[model samples]
Target: MLVLVGLLFPLLGCGGPKEIIVKGKVTYDGQPVDNGQIIFIPKGEGKVSAGPITNGEFNFAAPPGEMEVKITATKELAKAAKDGLPNYVSYIPKKYNDETSLTATVEDKAENTINFDLEK
Candidate 1:
């Protein structure tokens, strides 16, 4: 029916929100983070985005919103591994990852860049 077709036409054009590219840097104790990952959790109903932090920087596409960020970095202890003990060590403080208090607001725009300087 013509009426039915008209109603469905607009619905076809409706897609989800556009994801903006978000880029940033990460540091610990004034030094660049060697390697890690950054996660962005939306404050409201939305999808999450994540990216790897390599050499103190990372970039990923995320929906615009208020995001709670969590950053984690770790290293493997060669000595401990050879001794058959726990070999993994997390140099970053718990406050930056487990109990993260970091927040960033990303507006819907053409570009966004944020940086996190963490301390142990």
Candidate 2:
């Protein structure tokens, strides 16, 4: 019947898991991070999500689950790169990026607010 067909084909307006909207601010050594990137890596089987961080604020969508956070902020160097673009260096400690110890949870809610105050 039409009802059974509709249920069989999930592509036909079938409800599915939704992505949660997450917002937060980032600070380093008591100062707002001006420009950077924030990544939300799901601790389990989920998609990795990322967003741009500006003025210590950021917002992005992610699958609901436990997440590992990685923050990065770079400063422009005096010299230029081989591509002629301005060079930059990572100022945030590796503990906040490459080897991060920060974590957050994105639950099944309308929205979530998480903040991180980093230190050297």
**Local distance difference test, per candidate?**
0.89, 0.92
The worst-scoring run of ten residues by lDDT in candidate 1 lies at 74-83
Q: Report the lDDT tens digits of candidate 1 across residue range 10-83.
A: 99997877798999889999998888999999998888889999999999999999999989998777677766
Candidate number of the best lDDT: 2
Worst lDDT window (10 residues) for model 2? Answer: 8-17
Per-residue lDDT of model 2, residues 72-108, tens digit only: 9988899999999999988999999999999999989
The parts of candidate 2 lying over 4 Å away from their true place are: 1-4, 7-11, 78-85
Q: How much is the lDDT of residue 52 in candidate 1?
A: 95
RMSD of each: 2.2, 2.3
